[model samples]
Target: MSDQDPDIWSGIEDLWAWLDSHSPGDGQQSLLLRMLKLSEEVGEVAEAVIGAMNRNPRKGASHTWEDVESELCDVVITALVALRTLTPDTREVFVRHLARVRERSLGPGPGPRPA
Candidate 1:
């Protein structure tokens, strides 16, 4: 973790910059909107899962498991974008928060996560 080069995090930052440049609204407005978009993305994931499960008898299996997976990825991307919207140092913020969460969930001696 020594190097934080132009990788996924860089891409994440680039994505935020791109979106921010394209957006017409104010920074605060866009940040709020991004958060709402994350929620919408999450809802889409639920919808995709339901569709994959054919939960709605009326419309048997409208989505494949692959569709569900794509929707889930969208949710993650949307969430990361939202986090980026909230802070420019999203990489550090996320890493710090993730470490805290892992430490809280698993003790100090927490080893590699179960595969």
Candidate 2:
């Protein structure tokens, strides 16, 4: 959190612009494609995790933890890009939703103790 750090919203905006400009389809179709990209990124993450865990006998230890980490980044980037495609106010939308989620799980008040 410093002046040197790049703003995430700025990066999101830049990515949205780049994709929107290069996209072959119209707006609606492009948005749908972006949404589908999320699923693809998530699948990659799952594949990376499975490979790292050696969960698949046929491809034991095929991926390293670094690969899993990179895939996780891809999932985040894809999700953010999809959100940006859905709306121009991506930062506000994400922040409000995140606040609501945080409040629901860990609100301003404390919970009852275990009996």
Candidate 3:
């Protein structure tokens, strides 16, 4: 993954800006719609993976692991789009969420707290 290119949260910010410019009416887009779209992208990834893994390579049908990976990226993009639609400041949200997860993973620092 290129550091120059925005990661998922940064992608969300970019998507939010695009939506801001386009002004998708009333901000009433359904979450189900976004999820369904993401699912479709993921399905493509799965299909390509299955083809590459199980079927013999043919003359015209060139399905490879790379194709599956690209489709998986599309699924990630779709997910970022949905996340941006839900939260404007995805970076901050992600940072905070990450901090919480880290804290949980690390547990409370050695203090007077009981085991």
Best candidate (score: TM-score): 2
What global local distance difference test value does model 3 have?
0.72
Extract clashing residue pairs from model 1. none
lDDT digits (tens) for residues 9-102 of candidate 3: 6656776677556754456655556767888898888778777776534633457888988898888677777776677666677678877898
Model 1, 11-74: lDDT tens digits are 8888899999999999999988998998898888888888899998988899999998899878
Q: Which candidate model has the greater TM-score, 1 or 2? A: 2
Per-candidate TM-scores read 0.85, 0.88, 0.61
Model 2 TM-score, all chains together? 0.88
Pitting candidate 1 against candidate 3, the one with the higher TM-score is 1
In angstroms, the error of model 2 at 56 is 1.6
| Model 3 stretches astray by more than 4 angstroms | 1-11, 19-26, 55-62, 99-115
Candidate 2 Cα misplacement greater than 4 A, ranges? 109-115
On a 0 to 1 TM-score scale, where does candidate 1 land against the true structure? 0.85
Where does the lowest 10-residue lDDT sum fall in candidate 2?
105-114
Candidate topping lDDT: 2
